[model samples]
Target: MEGSNEELNPNAMTAEQTAALFSKLRRRRVSVAEVEADIEAGAPTNDAGRLNLLTYTAWMLKEAGRGE
Candidate 1:
């Protein structure tokens, strides 16, 4: 089910799209500024400046462990 959803959904998105989708998924307000800040802080993005959701999630999880 998850794989099918993954296949149907676009992997790469602009910061605005990413923020909107993330806000929907998390049921919270995710501002584009926050996403852009993450990118500025070294979150991965493709050459086209679109972020890969999977890659960003992985990077975020890895970063979350840094404080520990």
Candidate 2:
């Protein structure tokens, strides 16, 4: 049987949750190279721009974690 949405996603974060996380990362000022790596690894095909943004956000999160 297919899992319910909650079961499929234990964290149950919404798009708003994703956006908030991205926003925090943006405030950290991550580097472009790191963002490119994340884009290569995480985003779906033909979604270069979205992936780029998400990757950049992820990089920012990492940088923020390091206090950069």
Candidate 3:
């Protein structure tokens, strides 16, 4: 849900900023499936898609947070 805002300029963000951003997202208590469903589609298993898949899932997990 957090990433539903403006498109991210991954190039413009530092690792710390990204992590902190995700951390904030986690506190929002969104669901992994919610984030997944918001996206047009899931990532493929191809090598090129692996990182993207990981990033998407990580984002979802972040938004979902702990103790869920």
By TM-score, the best candidate is 1
lDDT of 3 by residue, 1-68 (tens): 25455555543432333444556756864444443343525422234222243565565576568544
Top model by lDDT, which number? Answer: 1
- Clash number by candidate, in order: 0, 0, 0
Name the lDDT value of residue 37 in candidate 2. 55
Model 3 reaches what TM-score against the true structure? Answer: 0.26
Name the 10 consecutive residues with the lowest summed lDDT in model 3. Answer: 43-52
Candidate 2 colliding pairs:
none
Full-model lDDT, candidate 1: 0.83
lDDT (Cα, tens digit) per residue for candidate 1, span 1-68: 22233333456788888887889899999999999999998999999888989999998899889993
TM-score for each predicted model, relative to the true structure: 0.81, 0.28, 0.26
Indicate whether candidate 1 or candidate 3 has the larger TM-score.
1
TM-score of 1: 0.81
Q: Candidate 2, residues 1-68: lDDT per residue as tens digits?
A: 12333322213323333444445646863444544454565533233244333444455577568764
Weakest lDDT window of 10 consecutive positions for candidate 2: 1-10
